[model samples]
Target: MNAQELRDKTPDQLRDELANLKKEAFNLRFQQATGQLENPARLRSVRRDAARVKTILNEQAAKAAE
Candidate 1:
């Protein structure tokens, strides 16, 4: 949801969350393509959330490397 919350999660949990967000993003895209998407905003939010998870993951990896 938020970076702070995501920061608190273990890498495994973060990966799982990222996967779910990707799935939701794909479904949202499909719904939009079919003209069935009720909330277009959700797509944006999911994308951002996925990005946040990725950023956090990278940060963790970088920290470990250091």
Candidate 2:
């Protein structure tokens, strides 16, 4: 998921996406701990995506407040 795509979504959608990303991140960590993670890159990607979503959410909230 890209920032542009995330920006196009509503706040509710963004929240949903963030939740899913966090869940995936947790699963990835579990796989790593279990020694079964196939793609290490995915863990990094999910973390970044979650951060991107958070940034966008903050930006939107700031806009709403102004």
Candidate 3:
């Protein structure tokens, strides 16, 4: 997803997306280890997406705390 798409998500939606991304990352890793993955780049993409969601979540939490 792009930055604008991420920005459009609410904190709750971001958290849900983060969870799904993490699950996908784990599955990708498993597939890679077993030589079943079709695209290694997908793992990297998922990781980055997860990070983006996490960063947004943290930013929201910090803003709320302030």
TM-score of each: 0.98, 0.98, 0.91
Per-residue accuracy of model 2 over 7-45 as CA lDDT, tens digit each: 999999999999999999999999999999999999999
Alpha-carbon lDDT of model 3: 0.90
lDDT of 1 by residue, 33-56 (tens): 999999999999999999999999
**Superior candidate under lDDT, 1 versus 3:** 1
Q: Which stretches of candidate 1 lie over 4 Å from their true place?
A: none
Residues forming the 10-long window of minimal summed lDDT in candidate 3: 52-61
**Predicted structure 1, TM vs. truth:** 0.98
> All predictions: root-mean-square deviation over Cα?
0.4, 0.4, 0.9
Where model 2 places Cα greater than 4 Å from the true spot, the runs are none
lDDT of every predicted structure (CA atoms)? 0.97, 0.97, 0.90
Residue 35 accuracy (lDDT) in model 1: 100
